[model samples]
Every structure is written in C-alpha cells, then in structure tokens.
Target: MNSASVISVVGPTGTGKSALALSLAEILDGEIVNADSMQFYRGMDIGTAKVSVAERRGIAHHLLDILDVTEEASVSDFQRQARQAIAEIQGRGKRAILVGGSGLYVRAVLDVLEFPGTDPRIRQRLEVEAEAHGMAELRARLQRVDPASAERVADDRRVIRALEVHEVTGKPFSSFMPVREYIQPTVQIGLDIPRPVLHERLSTRVNQMVDQGLADEVERLDQRGLRTGKTAGRALGYAQFLRVLDGEATVAAAAEETIIATRQFARRQSTWFRADPRIRWLDPREDDVVDQAAALCL
Candidate 1:
C-alpha cells in the first residue's frame, strides 16, 4: 500500500465495513479514522455496532468516542479531525484506513468540498420557517434555490443548513457539491449486497442489537440526557428505544420500527455512495474481500 494513500471502506450498515477495515489495517499497517456519525459518541456502542478494543486486533483507531451525546456533530469538525488523523498516521509511516457509511462525512474527508460559514440571523430565520411552516415548506423553498441540494437534504436540520449556506454564501448549496477531486491520494472500496439480502441482514442485526441490550443502553444514556441531545437523541435504534422507554411503544414494536428505519437509511446510503464513481465495488461475502480491497490500495 502507498504510504501517502488512505484506504476507505464504506457500505450500508451491517455490511461488514468494520471487519474489512480491520483486515486492511492489519495488512497495511494502518490506523482507522471513523466517519460514522453515531460512533463519535462515547457510549453509543451497541446500536452503532462500534468495534470493541478486543475486536480491533491491537490496530489503532481514531475519531471514535470523541464526543459527548449532548454535543452536535459538525461535518466540518469531522473533516478537520479526520484529515489530521490521516496525516498523523501517514506521517508515522502507516496507512490511514477510513471506515463507515456516512457519505457526506466520508466526502468531507476525501473531497475538495468547501463548507460555507453560517450567518446566525439567516439560520434563525430558516429555523422560524421550519417551525411555522414545516420542513416541507422550507424544502420547497430550497428546491427553488438549489434543486440538487434539496433532493439530498432529507431532514429538517439539513434542509435548514442548506438554506443557511445558500443565504450566507450567495450561492446555491448545490454549487458546492463535491467534485471528483481528492485532498490527498485515496482509495475507496465499497461493499455491495443485494437489496433483499441487505434487508434481511439489517433486520437480523437489529435483533442482535436488541439481544445485546440496546434498550438498556438507551435507558442508561437517557439518564445522561440523551433525549436532550440534538443529534444523538435521534439515532436509529436509540430513538425507537426511547419511545419504548416513554411507554409509547413496546420493545418488540420498537425493534420493528428500528428495522424499518434502518432499511430506509441503508437505501439512502446506497444512493449516496453509488453516485461516487471513484469507489471500487466488491462483495463483502467474497472470501478474498480484503485482498481485493488491498489490491486497489496498491
């Protein structure tokens, strides 16, 4: 592997990205820089499927467990931290293996995308619009200004941010879309699975998380003010389990909802990653998947 090149392992959740990243790190003398937004929180272990220290096989991992649940995760922050980690890894004569399915986070690290500064007054106005007229209204307004970004911004928060960027920069948010250029040499290996197979896998994974005490995990975090967290509170499994804790749903019902939400999230991940032509696709189930990825890095 080229010492200056970073290896990125990305796919939908439950597609063995962690496993592949571990393998690549073992082979390439690499350390990991996480891009999974949820994994940034300290105690969000089971639901995010964070690889335990024992599971990492003594390989170094960076950018995990670096945030409190109450703090909002900023992509610009992640981009800076991740690039620093990668540079340090490479400076130490090791490879940097980037992992996770968060597409924008991944792009922030690898692409030449510039984040426009936010104007407090503009953001305040957008927030008011979102609150009074609903996300659909702001989304429709965004479509008029930046149709491409409007298509990608799914949630109220992102829609607000996109509009804030457009207002602050006097440019459409879509005009800031990442070009096929890298800040540094990088190789991205994407794991691909059939939709039915991925769905089944995701369902089974959610059940495994439940069995592993995801509900109890959420309850513990709740005591630490997880519900008050802007970002952490809305995580996939944690949010559903919070409903269970509130007596709004049964554990079984929460699990079902989590499964459904996870499937939808996976579809979005697929769409985000499939648009990147730089990623080399491979099947995680292939016996030599790690070798295939390593070949690309070389």
Candidate 2:
C-alpha cells in the first residue's frame, strides 16, 4: 500500500465504524475526515451520534459541523473538501482515515465519481412541473428520458436533479454514477455485523438518544432554522422528533419510528457497501478485529 493511501472505515450505522476509525488513527498516526453527510451540519450532534471532542481523543477531524442546519450539503463540494483535507494530511506525513456510514459521500471521496452540474433555472422548472403535474408525472417523464436513473431514484430531490441533469447536460444522471475504481490509493475497511445484532443495537441506540434528551436537542435546533434545512430536517431522528414538536406524535412514538427507519436505512447502507468488492470486511465482533484491519492498512 502507498504510505499516503487513505484508510476508510465504512459500514452500516451502529456497526462501530467510528470506534474502529479512532483506533486505526491512533495506531497509524492518522487524522479523520468525516464522510457522514449528517455530521456536516452544526447542532446535529446527538441525532447523528457525532463523536464528541473528548471522545475524539485529540485526533484532528475535518469536515464535521462545517454547515449550518439550513444549508444543503452538496456531494461535489464535499468531494473537493475531503480530497483537499486528505492531501493536506498526507503532506504533513500522517495517514488520512475516512470514516462514516454515508455510502454515497464515502464513494465521492474514494471512487471515480463525477457529479453533474446543476442549473437553477432548469431545477426550478422541473420543480414547478412536478408541483403542477405530480411526482407520478415527473417520474414518468424521467422514465422516458433516463430509464436507469428512473428505476434507481425514489426521492423527489433526486428525481428532479436527474431531470435537470438531462436538460442541462443532455446526458443520463446514471452516467455520472461512481465506478468501483478508486481515484487514489485507498484501503476501505467495512465492519460486518449480523442483521439481528445490528437491529437490536440501533433500537437500543435510539432509545439511549431519547434518554439523553434528543427531543431537547431537536427543539434547540428547531429554533435555529432546522425546519428550513432541506437535508438536516429530514434526517432519521430529527424528522420523527419534528413531529413530536408539532404535537402529531409523542417522544416514545418518535423513538420507535426512528428505530424502524434507522434499521431500514442500515439495511440500505449494508446493501450499498456490500456491493463494493474493494472493501475488506471484518466482523467487528471478532476479538482481534482492530489488529486485522491495521494489518490490511499496513
């Protein structure tokens, strides 16, 4: 492996990626660059399970809390920032450890991914059409233009972006998808845990967050324009708890919903990361998992 190669710790949520990344950084004299999209927003800490300053153990971490809740995060911008951070870390003679469960964001840093540029006029036109015609209409249009992306994209935001890409660049959005090929020397370590174990862990973690005043945290952020945040407002716990604030649900109900949503999200994450052949899988339950991962990096 190249000495300056990036070490990426990736997996589903509640799989101990952060803990392993911390251990790897300590052992390899590394700095951490966050790839989790949710962790980018300030005041999103408790819900995102952001590692605290004390928990970081003085390890320099880049790209956490860099955006306000109201601002949307762009994968293209993050790719630039993360690569710059990695280069700076390498230039200082320290390894750069990339950590997070956000699969697309991770790939944006490690893989040969190209993001399509957006034109606001085109996006606004699409948005208006969707509102006037409905998502079913828009989805049908997308199917006509880009069958692959239409099949893959489910959300309103991405569907519009796909149409916008087709309009502006006259190319399918799927064409810009990341290839498995790495852009640089990299070793990706994926934590493998049983589905049953992961589900239980996610449930327990969500409950713990509730006990730790996740509602209060959400309330504080809500006062800070969190509701206006297109990305952060829709996060796993934050969205559910936002209902609590609206009197549409109780805290317990929100926690239960968050647990179910998180488990589903984790399943999607597992599917995404498992598709990548480059990642070396380690059962985090193993006694010598850290040693095994360190050996791969070395």
Candidate 3:
C-alpha cells in the first residue's frame, strides 16, 4: 500500500461488506471508515446497522454520525471528510479500510468522479422539477437529453443529478463517474452472494430492523423536523415506512415493497461495480476474503 493507500470494500447490502471490512481492518492494522450514507446518522442505528463502539473495538473508525440529521451533507462533504480520515489513519502508520454499500459515496471519496461543485440554482430548479413531474418524468428527460449517459444511470436520483450537472457544468454527469485517474492506488474488494440468498437476507434484515424499533426511530427523526428531501431522511427502510405512516400502504406492504426496492437497487449496484475495471470481486464464503484482498494489495 506504500504507506498511504486506501482499502475499499464495496457491494450490495447483505453481501457481508461490513463484516469483511472489519475483519480486514483487524488483520491488516487498518482503521475503518464509514462509507454508507445511512450509517452516517446518529439516531437511526438499528436500520442502518451502524457498527457499535464495541463492534469497532477501538480500532479507530471515522466519518460516521458527524452531521445532524437536519444538515445537508453532499458528496463534496464526503470527499473532504474521507480524505481527512485517510490522512489521519496513514499518519498513524495504519491502513485505511473503507466499508459500505454506498458506491457513489465511496467513488466520491476515492475521487472516481471529477465532482464539479454543484450550482445551487441548477440543483434547486431540478429538484423542484423532480418533485413536480416525478422521478419517472425526470428520468425520461435525462434519456432525451443524454441517451448514452441515461443507459448507464437510469435511476431517478442519478438522472436528476445528471441534468443538474449538464445545466451547471455544461457536461454530462457520466463524465465525472468514470474519471478513474482521480482514484489513488486503492485495492478494491467486493462480496459476491447469490441473488435469491441475498434477497432472503435482505428480507430478514428488514424484519429484524422493524423488531428493533425501526418505526420508533423513524418517528423520532421525523419529529426532529428533518425534510424528506435530505438524503438521510430518504434511507431505504425509513422512506418506505413513511408511506405507511401517511396511510398510503400497510406495514406489511411497506416491508415487502422495501425488500423489492432494495433488491433492484442491489442489481443496479452490481452493474455499476461491473463497469469499473479496477475492482477485484470475490465471495465471502470462498477462501479468506482478507487473504484474497491482501494478495491484490501486494
């Protein structure tokens, strides 16, 4: 790692990404950095599966729960905080182990994106359009405007973001996501799990979260006056549960809907990682993930 490299763990949720990263941190003398966007909140613990201090076990973790739920933390903020975390870990003669399923957050921190600073007017107007015309409409707009880019990222969030970039930077958003030169000499590892098994695990996890008072957690956060527009508020489980609260769906329906949405999101994540040529993919159950990862780093 040349004393300054970062170790990145990425994949869909239920792929043992956190477990693998924590294990690798202990073995490799590394400090864990939170890369998941939802885990960055303080109160939403169970649903986010935030690593407990006991789980961290004093190995030194960074950039988790640094912002209040009300604050709007952007990709730029993640990049800034992540660099500081890596520098601190490197300064201590330890490797930095990044752990999460938030590929955009990981990519932003690793500088895979040439991430132009956002223009407020462009974002504000687009956000308004997204709210008015719906995610589908905005996605169609992106397809019409940038067909090639649309094929790569058809999600509502990415579509809106691409439109914002085009409006502000006069360039397509896909340009930033593929700027691989911005990355350090990072060793990327992925956890591979079968699709059906992954779906079962996600369903079980969501149920466990509900039993762990996920509803109460969301209610508390809601009372804090956090807006729906904020990223933290739109976390997978919480976002769907809010629909139940609004009488739009039953609790069971919400849970099932969340599971389906998550699985689809996972598929998209898998595709995104596939497009990156530098990553080394592996399975948690096959051999030692650490041994395989260490071999790659060396």
Candidate 4:
C-alpha cells in the first residue's frame, strides 16, 4: 500500500485535465502538484490557466506560482521540487496527483532521466546562435547527433536542451538519457477528445483568456522587466503579448500568433503522450475519468 503511487493527469491544453485531476484529488484525498511549466510562475494566471484558490475546490495543490517571472526555472528545478512534494504528500498518507500539459516536465518527474547541468559558456554560445540562426537550426543540429532523442522531443526548446547536454558533457545527448523507468506504484491518465472538439475548445479558451485580462497580466510582467529570456516571460502567450507591448505587432496579430503557437504546442504534446506507454489513454467523453483513475490506483 504505497500511497506514494502518483495519479498523473496528462493531456494537451484545453482538455479538462486540470478539472479531472482536481476531482480525483478530492475523491482520493490527494494533493495535486502542477506539472505544467508555465503555471509555475507568479502573476501568470490567465494564459497559464493557473488553478485559482477558489477553483482548487478546497483541495491542496503544490508547485504552482512559487517562482517570480524573472527567475530561471528549468526541468531540473521542477523535478527536484516535484519529487519533494510527492514525498511530503505520501508521508502525510495522501496521494499525489501530478497535473499539467508540459510533457517534458511530466516525463522528467516520472522517469529517471538526468537533465544535463547548465554551463555558462555553452549556454551563451547557444543563446547567440539561437537568436541568430533561430531555435530550429539548433534543433536540426541535435537531430544529426541523436535522432532518437530528437523524435522523442520534436521541438526547438527541447532539442536545444538536448543539444546543451551534448555540448556541455562532451557526450551524445542519448548517452545521458535514462533507459525506460516505470513509475512504481503509479498510474497515469491521459485525456483526449475529437480533434474538432479540442480545437474548438482551444479557440474558446484563448478567447476567454483575452477576456479575463491575460493582456494585463503580461503587461504587469513587462512593467517588472521580466523579459523573454526568463522562463516565465517566454511562456507562449506572454511572448506574443510582448510583441504587442513592444509595438512590434497589433493586438489582433498578437492574439492570432498566440493561438497559432499554442496549437502547435498542443500537437507536440499529443505526439509525445501518445507514444508514452505508461499512460492509460482515455477519452474526454468517458463517463468517469476519476473513477477510472482510482481503479488504476487501487
């Protein structure tokens, strides 16, 4: 009876993963720990869809909004904090429900991968190149070094991170990647809906964020001088909003750009989660996602 068994709610954005996690937390007397990268920052509410105090439904949540927008938070930071929270919850004889759409952060927590440590010189070089030739070019270079890792992480940021491993450690990125590690006593749940439905929901969700003052949130962060180099500042909506704030783009254009970027991010999440065998994929229309999760937990 390892109460430490994690109940992880994972899916692309706008799929009600948070809602499912909260409901299961309440039913199972569990505590929820955020796995989303964006949701970890303070003052990043609307666009991150951060669970508000009221919306927590009197359930305890961990690792949300503990960092300033100017801080540099990475997968290693997340993994350390998440593992601590999980241990604490299990010590309290409660369950830990890991919830979010950030597939990298989620996998880092569930698996045994050791993310490469950062090096100042390599990072400075990559930053210069990333801003010069673009993140795509760096990602392509990573593909030449390790195609398997590239497929598992088919994006600029992750590919850049894997590249960092190779450059810093003088080892192929895959050489550092951990072999498959089961999350002992853990059960994973992935949520999915029809593509049309999901996209429609995504559109409405973005519009709702606009109405809920996401622009103002970004503006506040901007006023604080939290530029795009910081983790929180680089969050999708904030980056687009930064364009509008810089007078580099129009409101309509920025909003459209945000939507387009988010859609592509969701596509990548689906690709990774679909390939993760640990997750028990479930339809969003399933009669009882929590019940199914609890069954798996037992």
Report lDDT per candidate: 0.91, 0.95, 0.79, 0.82
1-298: candidate 1 lDDT, tens digit per residue: 4546888999899899999999888888889999999999999999999999999899999999999899999999999999899889888999899999999899999999888787879898888877888788888989999999888777788889889998888898878878879887888999979999999999999999999999999999999989999899999999999999999999999999999999999998998899888889999989988888888888
lDDT of 4 at 60: 92
* Model 4 local distance difference test score: 0.82
Task: Give the per-residue lDDT of model 4 (tens digit) for 1-298.
Answer: 3546888899899888998988888778899999998887888899898889999999999998888888877888888899899989989999989999888788888887777777878777887899998877887788798787887775466677778888788777777765558555778889988777887788888878888988888899887766944677778889998888889998778888888888878888898788888788887677876687677776
Q: Between prediction 1 and prediction 4, which has the larger lDDT?
A: 1
Clashes of 3: 0
RMSD of 2: 0.8
How would you encode candidate 2's per-residue C-alpha lDDT over 1-298 as one tens digit per residue?
Answer: 8767899999999999999999999999999999999999998999999999999999999999999999999999999999999999999999999999999999999988888888999899989988898899999999999999999999999999999999989999999998889988999999979999999999999999999899999999999999999899999999999999999999999999999999999999999999999899999999999999999998
TM-score of each: 0.95, 0.99, 0.87, 0.88
Candidate with maximal TM-score:
2
What clash pairs does model 4 have? none
Ranking by lDDT: 2, 1, 4, 3
Candidate 1 Cα lDDT to native: 0.91
Total clashing pairs for each candidate: 0, 0, 0, 0
Task: Name the runs in model 2 displaced over 4 angstroms.
Answer: none
